[model samples]
Target: MPKQIEDQKKILLRVRKISGQVQAIERALIEQKNCDAILQQICAARGAMNGLMHELLEVHLKDTLVVNQSSEQERSEELQNISKILKSYLK
Candidate 1:
C-alpha cells in the first residue's frame, strides 16, 4: 500500500468517523433536517479536513524539509516558504 494509505490506517478511526458524519449529513439533508444542524455538520467536516491537512503538512515538513536542510540559510529559506504557504492557505 502507499505510504499515505499506510499512515491513514493508523488514524483510520478518525477517518471512518468523519465519513460516517458526512453520510449522516447527507441523510439529514434528504430528511429535511434543521438548516442550522446541517450547517453545523458541514462546519465540523471542514474542521476535520483541515486537521488532516495540517497533520500531513507537519509530517512532510519534518520528514522531508528538516532532513534536507544542510545549512542555516537553506533552513531559513524553507521556513520563509512555509510561512508563505500558510498565509496563502489561510487566505
Candidate 2:
C-alpha cells in the first residue's frame, strides 16, 4: 500500500496525459490534418505510451521486488522474471 501510494499521483498524471494525446489524435483525424503531421503525432503518442510503460515497470520493480527482497536467491529469481517480462513487453 505504501509503495503504491508513492507513485500514484505521478502515474495518474501520466494516464491523463496519455488520454489527452489520444484525444488529440482523434481531433487530428477529424480535421484531416496533413499526412506527415498526423503520422508524427501518432509517433509521439506511441512514445508517450512507452514512457508510461517504463514508469509502471519501475514502480513494480521497486515496490514488489526491491522493497520486499528477502534473500539473494529470491532476488535473482525475481530479477530473471522481470527481465523476461520486459523482453516480452518490448517485443
Task: Say which candidate scores most in TM-score.
Answer: 2
Worst 10 residues of 2 by lDDT: 1-10
Q: Best candidate per lDDT, number?
A: 2
Q: Show the colliding residue pairs in model 1.
A: none
Clashes of each: 0, 0
How would you encode candidate 2's per-residue C-alpha lDDT over 1-91 as one tens digit per residue? 2277759888888889989988988999999999898898889889988998889888877887778856888888878998998899879
The TM-score of predicted model 1 comes to 0.62
23-91: candidate 1 lDDT, tens digit per residue: 989999999999999999999988887877687677657655665646888778878988898999899
lDDT of each: 0.76, 0.84
TM-score per prediction, in order, is 0.62, 0.79
Q: What would you estimate as the lDDT of candidate 2?
A: 0.84
Q: What is the overall TM-score of model 2 with all chains considered together?
A: 0.79
